[model samples]
Target: MGMEFVDLFNQWASSYDDTVAGKDPEYREVFEGYEEMLERLANLSKSPVMEFGVGTANLTRKMIEQNKVVLGVEPSSEMRRIAKVKCPEAAIYDGNFLEYPSLLTPIRSIISSFAFHHLTSDEKREALQKFREHLEDDGEVIFIDTLFKDEAHKQALIQDAEKQGFLNLARDLQEEYYPYLEDIKEIFVEEAFEVTFEQLNKYAWLIQARKGE
Candidate 1:
């Protein structure tokens, strides 16, 4: 609730979806891929899912209709509360990547959208390990976010966002991934997960990985 990064998102939670609905370029080709991937991963109607940083419950609601019992985790209480209203049918938890909620039972799939980038590099690695430790042997992860090619981009992002204020919160809070592809790969490779990156548009893309099933 008090985290600077979290607080910023919480403050924007109420209008998060509308603010991001169509602005992002990473969303392309993801819906079709995910629709098919859901069946390939597990029974969408039966598989349980945990959405990290499920702000405003935009995608959470969409996934739930496909039948995966979705549980969302967001660090911002303001975001979580707003998400709850948007996704009344799904369960949402207030927590950061460093911790998990007691309510989360067991999940076969963990999904994140534009959320993972908020973490520091160390936190990102730890979170990947955390997922490996907690996920079922065959679990998979789907992440979509804005990745930086190098430090220059990272700094530019912060500066750009600072000038824009809350409007640039998502871009402002980000982590670095040199050769972005490999860095993302490291996040899940050890867990027997494979990476696939799709640059939907400029500065954004989708990373889909699957664990050994």
Candidate 2:
């Protein structure tokens, strides 16, 4: 991530929780079932996990409630600050998906939520490679984010957002680096990971990928 994104997130940190909680009318559908999605992701993940883009530590809190050891990586200082207060048991660091402090031991799982779209396809692949390096041989990667079934599905969403007069949502859909399902599956396969996807809501999907034996 770049300084621009960091600044954007820094600015958003204060109200991110509210936005995700469906307080933002325009983004309500996008964040529908927010609590359920976090619970599902936390349940799927294993202990000694490393979570990227741990915004406000919502997911971190869930994992901690499950007695999972979590290391949170976040680029925004403000987000990290809030996350620390919310999830004091977890270690929250100042870093992005692609670059973070190295772990002394391989983690059992690598996880994230809603934040993976910040990276482009190439960057996603690069981050996956790094994740492979940091994970145990049998570790898994779990992420919940907005992903399209295909190019057409993505376009339809953008058009729908525009029709709803959700200009900000429409612009975000157009500007972000959200990936196609098939493309992400191919990338995971190429990296020797077995992956699966389940739609959690109209906008988000749960991706569960495991390292190949």
Per lDDT, the best of the predicted structures is 2
In order of appearance, the predictions have TM-scores of 0.73, 0.96
Candidate 1 accuracy as TM-score: 0.73
lDDT of each residue in 81-132, candidate 1, tens digit only: 8778878988887787778676447667788766676666667777777777
Put down candidate 2 lDDT per residue, 1-213, tens digits, no spaces. Answer: 434588889899999999999999889999999998998889989989999999899999999999888888999999999999998889998888888897888899999998888898888888889888888989999999999999899999999999989999999888888888998899999988999999988899989899985
The superposed Cα distance between candidate 2 and the true structure at residue 31, in angstroms, equals 0.9
Off by over 4 Å in 2: none
Angstrom error at residue 198, model 1? 1.1
- Span of ten consecutive residues with least summed lDDT in model 2: 1-10
